[model samples]
Target: MGIVLNQSLKNTIITYLGFGIGAINTLYLYPFFLGTVFYALTNYILSWANIIMPLLAFGMQNTLVKFYTQYKTEEERSRFLSFTVLIPLLLCIPLVLIGLFFFEPISLYLSKENPVVKDYLWLIPFIGLSMAYFEIFYAWARVHMHSVFGNFVKEVGLRLFSLFALIGVYYEWISVVEFIYVTAIIYFLACIITMLYAFHIKKPVFQFSIPQNVKDVLVYTFFIILSGSVAVMLLDIDKIMLNQYIKIENIAYYSVATYIASVIAVPSRAMHQITYPITAKLMHENKHDELNDLYKKTSINLQVVGGFVMLCIFVNINQLYVMVPKEYSGGILVVFLIGISKYFDLILGNNNAIIFNSKYYRMVLFLGLLLVFLTVGLNMFFIPRFAITGTAVATLLSITLYSLAKLLFVVKRMHLYPFTHQTLYSLAITFGIFLSFYFWEFPFSPIISIGLKSALVTLLYVYINYKFVISIEINQALDLVLKKLKIRL
Candidate 1:
């Protein structure tokens, strides 16, 4: 817990900084400078790349984490790392070749509704390959307990680069088409930097020998591909499907809404970076007691933090829309629906880590694949009628069912749960604060109003949670801050 909290705090700060830059890019700079069509194209390209990343990497990133600590010697570990890295590199050859062979037909299908996507179709696999190696190297660093730098590079570095690219578009130094190309280069650059840092952490021996547990590793990697694909598809599939039914520019609106709601996930994202390796280690050792304890702590702590962000976003969503272009404001319902789904996901804490590292991962993978089908079906039904908002509806229902299944599986199979009585208290407090603050708006400008109301919501939410001792971990941290400020509670 000590190391978890320490690095989690650092990662949280870094993730939010990245999200801040990203929020600026997604909400204002991209839409205002690039126009909604190209903005949607940028998002569409990246989303498809993300969907393709898992298949390209052959699930080596997760396999590395789940197996790294199991080896007994440095030579064996080196062999395993060699296998993880080299397999993904070798697999990309055939995938890329196949993609090139079918390129025109694939491009035609994707750009049916909007031909703006045709020229950019080549970029997806290039970026996906970059994203695949980035995760493999990122997991390489994480197993060595060196996640903060990788997290910074991943969270801050990419978005910071995008910020500069978008600014170049605004200043007429680069055209929007060049901005799209630059975005692909940025991802590849991030992958190279992370690989270098990982090498610095522990210089690889690059052994060509197969690992002793090669069969087990391969099987796990196979299922993890399905698992990873399921999770990524849940997050980005809506945007991809939105392209099929609606105008490309409308995805820009959905992207804005989803990005705003995604801020609530910062805590979970931060903690998962550190907790994942720890969870893997614990499950490997058969330390169920300690694993369950970590699970509960992560659950409550994330809910407390994530709930506040959700409340702030929900209450101030209207004010937020005021600052963006009017066309983008149509995504308010998308924000609310996606925000609730993300908050549900946030409270699950280490549920994903627990399942992915466990022996029953195959069962959950089957369930996840089924749910992906359900998500696609729901989108097919909803999108033709309601457009982007309907996409949000499909996402909300699919993800809620998926989350509930994961939660129940952990409880029924492992006999471990991530909630306490304090969970209910946190929910009640969240609703109370939301109701009190949601109905009115400040008389000032949008930025000032958001600042004033967010400050008030923060104070009241913190005071109530701290007053009732909702989470001991949170209260202890709050005590430290208050002590430093010489303030009494």
Candidate 2:
């Protein structure tokens, strides 16, 4: 718990700093500097890459985390590491070949609705390849208990470079076309940096020999590919489908609203970095008691923090939208629906880690495949009628059903529940705070109104939680922060 606290706090700060820069890029720079058409193109290319990355990487990122600690000998671990790294290339090379042979037809299909996408179809595989390897190396670092550097490179480095790229576009140093190409270059560089850092953490010893559990490892990786694909598809497929059904520029509008809601998942992402490998280690050792404790603690702590973030977003969304361009202001409902879904996801805590590392992982693949089809079906039905709002509704439904299924599986199979009495209390507190402050706005500019309302919400929420002690872990964290600041609470 101590190590989890320390690393999660650091990762959270880094992630938010990255998100802060990303918010600027998403809201102000991309729309204003790049224009909506180019902005949407940028988003569309990346979302396409994300949707295909699991296949490109062959699920090695998660495979490394799940299997790395099980080996008893350094030689065996080296063999396993080498296997994870090189096996993906087997799939990647074939994919590139297929893309080369079928490029024309694929491009025509992708660009049927919007011809702008035809010229940039090549960037998807390029960026997806880079992203796939980046995760592979990042998993290498995570298993070594050194995740902060990888987290920084992942969360902040890429966004910071995008900021520079956008500025270059602003100064006319680069055309928007070149800016699009540079975005792919940024991902490639990030992958290289992470790979180098991973090496620095522990120099690799390449071995051609396979481990004894090769069959088990390959089977897990095979199923995990489906699970990983399903997860990424749920998040990014909406953006891809949007390009097909509507004008590409609307993606920018939808992107901004989704970015605001994504902040709610920050705490969960930060905590998952360290907690994932820890959960794997615990499961391997059959430490159910400690694992169960981690499950409940993570759920409550994440809900407490994530609930506060969701509250802030819901309360300040109207004011915040006032600051963005009027065209993007229509995504308010998208934010609400998506934000609630993300909060539900956060409250599940380490459920994913537990399931993916356990024997029940194959179950995820079956359920995930069903949801993937369901997601696509719902998007097809909803997007033509509702546009971006329909996409959000599809996402909300898919993720809610998916999370519910995973939660139920964990409860039935593992006999672990993330919810407790505090869960209800936390929900009550969030609803109360939202009701009290949402309509109470200051008579000022959008920025000032947001600040005033956010401060009041944070203070009242924290004070109430502190006074009542909603979560012991959160109370302890608050106490530690107050002590560090030399303030009496």
lDDT of 2: 0.94
Model 2 collision count: 0
Task: Point to the candidate with the largest lDDT.
Answer: 1
Best by TM-score: 1
Deviation in angstroms for 355 in model 1?
Answer: 0.2
Quote model 2's TM-score.
Answer: 0.99
Write one digit per residue (lDDT tens) for candidate 1, span 1-489. 999999999999999999999989988899899999999999999999999999998999999999999998988999899999998888788888898999989889988999889999899989999999999999999999988999999899999999999999999999999999999999999999999999999899997789888899999999999999999999999989988888999899999999999999999999999999999999999999999999999999999999999999999999999989998878999999999999999999899999999989999999999999999999999999999999999999999999999999999999989999999999999999999999999999999999999999999999999999999998999899999999998
lDDT of 2 at 37: 94
Give TM-scores for every candidate, taking all chains together and pairing residue i with residue i.
0.99, 0.99
Task: Give the whole-model CA lDDT for all candidates, comma-separated.
Answer: 0.95, 0.94
